[model samples]
Target: MIIPVIMAGGSGTRLWPLSRTAFPKQFIALTSNLTMLQETAARLDGLSGDDGISPMVICNEEHRFLVAEQMRQQKLTPSILLEPAGRNTAPAIGLAAIKAVEDAKLASASNELTEFPVLLVLAADHVIEDVEAFQQCVKSLLPEVQAGKFGTLGIVPTEPATGYGYIKATTSSGRLGRVSEFVEKPDAETAARYVAEGYLWNSGMFLIRADRYLEELKNFRLDIYDACVKSMASTQLDLDFVRIDKEAFEACPDESVDYAVMEPLAAKGEVVVAPLDAGWSDVGSWSALWEIADKDAQGNVMAGQDEKNFILQGSENCYVYGSAGNDGSGRLIATLGVENLVIVDTPDALLVANKDKVQDIKKIVSQIKASG
Candidate 1:
């Protein structure tokens, strides 16, 4: 069985105005008609394993309704796991692994079936343009996962980007290779060098056996494993949502899956990487949104209700994201001779910044919170 676990607990402060604390990037329809969460679930249309395929979503407690509603729109009834607090990916994934094991055992007992589930861990806010290519990448990693080795998709770097972490593969061989090391986000020069060396952008997508992940997490980060087990022991299922104990999860350490598990495993040469060349973007910033967005002849992306609503006068390489008549009334947004700018207009906030500095937009969000 291939169990897809969608991690959807990020605030996405970098994409401030439109992506707020209440409604983050994952819930927004950034690139397509479907929201990013919907797209994530929809992209798994044709995938199946030996047993079967079902998605298990881990999201913020506050956004449980939003996640359920979005998945419901796509006619998908995924098992929603609610995190009472933001304990990061390590604990989040641990919870999923624990649940998967428990569920598999129950199925085996009830139906008299032997089942082993392989988890396909995906981020909810990624923009993978080529669904076929993405599916192929997952197919390529299945063998490694089935072979009892931890596997993750490593994106073939199209550019020297400093925003994402890099994965150093042991050998630049075929579609799959042993992961050498995982590096932190680097400076410009370091990123360029990594690109030259054929390092991949760590896509944060994992394919591993449910039991194996739990065993490994128990081995490497026992504290996280214990907390997740305790949290799951007290899990309460409310309709379509599985709510973990808040106080127990709050006491769990805040760490990423990479820091707690993948890194340590990679260091021991137990991790494998599948190189994915699909057009994948984390959609972490406004500039990232511009990169994936469809643009005009002058390298400008003007998003609104109609062409007439947004008049770009000699603007080159600019991104304007807003909706005319968004809330039943219209607002015409015009740009005059502005080059390389990002203008985002939302109901409560408006943001304007240089395209190059969009990565630092999180600073503005921090200031806003400070003022309040």
Candidate 2:
């Protein structure tokens, strides 16, 4: 059974003003009519197999209502798992895998299924324009995942992106290859060289058996494994959400899935990388958002409102994300001869930045938090 584990716990402050701490990017409709969370759930519509099961979502407790409401909008009643605090993806997925294993065991007792479920780990806020290609990539990795190989979908680099981490594959030319190493975000020159050498962007998407992931987690990070096990065992049902014990989960270490499992396992040749050429973007910053969005002849993307709302005289290659009716700002943003700028208008805040410096938007967010 290919059960999706959607990781939706992130405060997307980089796309700030639009994506707030209370209502992050995953819950916003940045791409299409559907919000990113809804799109994540909707993307699996046509995927079917005898072993396929419904999706399981792991999100922040603060966004529990938002998650539930978004899923309800799509008529998808997924098993929503709520974390007490943000412990990063490692513990979040670890606990989800543990719960999936328990559910599988219960089903086995009832003769529903005899095999362990394959967990398709996906981030909630990614934008993949090519759904068919994405599904094909996932289908291709199913057998390898069922065979106990940790399969990570690596995005084929369209550019030397310094925003995303790169996954170095052992072989350079195939759709799938053994992962050699995982590299952190690099400098511009280093990123360009990595692109030339054929390194894939670490997509953070994985397909692996639930039990297998638990086994590997136990082997690689016993502390995280044990904490997740304990937390899952004491989970409480709250309406449609499963709430883990706050104190128990609070004791868990904060780490990403890369550090807790994949990096160590990749070093041991246990992880495989599936190169995905599907148009994928994490939308890490305003510049990234501009890169993917459709632009006018002047290379300006006027979000929230239409071109009529944003009167760009000579603004070439700029992104203006104005306040929608939801923002309650009633603000109309207009640009002059500005080029390569990002103008975001919100109810409580407004940001105007250079496109090249958008990556450092997080620093401004950090400063705001520090002041408070």
Candidate 3:
């Protein structure tokens, strides 16, 4: 049995205005009909047959309703673990690992079960176009993972993307090899060099046996491991959500799973990289969305527009109307002649900026927080 753990905590300030603190990137439908979270969970359906395990989700306390609603729409009542605060992937997975261990215990007692539990941890915001191939890649890594190896799915780089970290791997130790190193997001030349050297995008997708992950967490991040185990054991089960003790969770250090566990385990454990070629995109920013968006003849995106009814730099495609939103204002914003512009219409905040300056949207988000 392999339990899929979806990590769905992100403020998404980079894709700001549209993606806010209340509604993060995971819930946003940036590229597809299905929201990113929905897509992430749906992608794992094929991998959860009778022999495999059902998915469990770890999300922010604020986002439990959104997570549960969406999962319910798909008729998937996932075991939801609500974090009191975001202490990064290490804590998120720590909670899920605890729950997965309990689940494994329950499964072991059941007459229908026949296998140990493997945990596939994934971010809820990622977009993977090729579902079957993604499952195949997960299946391929199961053997190593079940053997108590810490495995991560690394995307074969299509370009030198500075947004993502890199995993350096080679086939020196049987099928699964020791990770040479985990590098941070590199500069242009360095990213290019890493790509040339055949480094893989650190996709943040992880595979490990449920109980084994707990053991490693105990070994590496002892305090977090101990506290999380205690918290989950005495956790408050509220309907679909498990409410972790806030003081207990906040006491844990704010380190990512990669830094707190994975990176350190690189040398000692069977840290292998599974090659994922499934058109994966984290969609961390608005520009990332624009990259994958359908464009018009003038290379302008339909969602990109200049509001204020002012004509700016962009293809002069006649009257370009922006959605009159950001407060349900109902003000139809139309530009006569604009080129290379971006207009985002959200429920409470509207963004109108140069398309080239979309990356700077975080500055606006920061100001809003500063003013408060």
Candidate 4:
């Protein structure tokens, strides 16, 4: 059985103003009428080969309706697990795995136990154009996934991008070698060196058996395992979501799955990588959005409206929205003199910032939260 787990709890601060606190980038119709979360779910629909199974989603409580409603839009009735609070990927995945295992146990009248589910964990905000290639990538890993290996998919890097983390891999005798190392997002010089060395972008997509992942989590950082166990044990089925115990989950560390599990599992588990060159993007910044946007001859990406004459001028590689001023949904956003800038307009505010320093938008988000 293949169980898909979609993690949808990111604060898309880099896409601020247009993507606000109440409704983040994942739920906003940025590139198309479909939101990022909707696109993510639809991508899975394209992976319908080799008897793919139903998907289950895990998200923070605040995003419960957003994730569920998006899935519903696609006509996919997915089971959702809402974390009472954010405890990162490890605990989130753990809760989903626990539920999958429990549901697997209530055997059908035929008394046939289901195959240990192979979890295909994906982020809800990633952009991948070649849906065919993405599905092929998943199918290619099925053999290894069934062989009890903790499988991962790696996106072929298109550039020496300093914004993305890299994965070093070696192949021998037609078999993918172990994960050499999980490197952090490097500086410009380091990124160039890594690209020259043929490192792949770590796409954060994993394929692991429900039981094997839990076993490894138990063996490693027992702190995570203990907290997840308590949380899942106290989980309740509410409406369509499995609500994990908040008090127990809040006690769990806020470490990411990369830092808490995957980094270490590179040595402990048989971590293997599958190459995916499907025009993937995390949409981490304004520049990334432009890279994936439809561009004109002058390299101008005008999405959502006629952007030939932005409210300002001299602006190239900028994203502009003209939501109304009364509600911040339809305001003219023309630039007279700007270049490499990002202008995102929403009902409550307008964000104008340089493209390069987009990562700092999180600081502004933190400040807003503190003030509120």
> lDDT tens string, model 2, 71-116?
8888778999999999999898898888887888787867454797
Per-residue lDDT of candidate 1, residues 1-372 (tens digit):
788999999898998888888999899888888898988988898877343456999999999899988887877788999999999999999999888888888878574326678889999999887888888878888887887899888999999999999999976555688997988789999999999999999999999998898889999899999999999998898997999999899999999998888888989988888888778899998898898888999999977455667889899999997755446445788999999999988767888999999999888989999999
Scored against the true structure, residue 133 in model 1 reaches a CA lDDT of: 84
What RMSD does model 1 have? 1.8
Q: How far off is residue 97 in model 4, in Å?
A: 1.1
Q: All candidates' TM-scores?
A: 0.96, 0.96, 0.88, 0.91
Q: Which tens-of-lDDT digit does each residue in 1-372 have in candidate 4?
A: 678888887777777766765677888777777988788777886465666456888877888888777878888878888877777788888877777777777755543445777889988778998988887778878788788888888878899887777887784222355686777688989999988888888888898888888888888878888898898887787898888898998999877777676778776547888788889999877778888888655566666555543455565666665564444345466676567776776566767778777878878778888999
Worst 10 residues of 2 by lDDT: 323-332
Q: For model 1, what is the alpha-carbon lDDT of residue 67?
A: 90
> On a 0 to 100 scale, what is the lDDT of residue 320 in model 2?
90
What are the per-residue Cα lDDT tens digits for candidate 3 across 139-245?
88887777778888888888998888888888422234457777767888999999988888889999987777787888998988977877786789899688988
Off by over 4 Å in 4: 50-52, 108-114, 172-177, 305-314, 324-329, 370-372
- Give the TM-score (vs. native) of candidate 3: 0.88
User: What lDDT would each prediction earn against the true structure?
Assistant: 0.87, 0.87, 0.76, 0.77
Off by over 4 Å in 1: 49-52, 110-113, 325-329
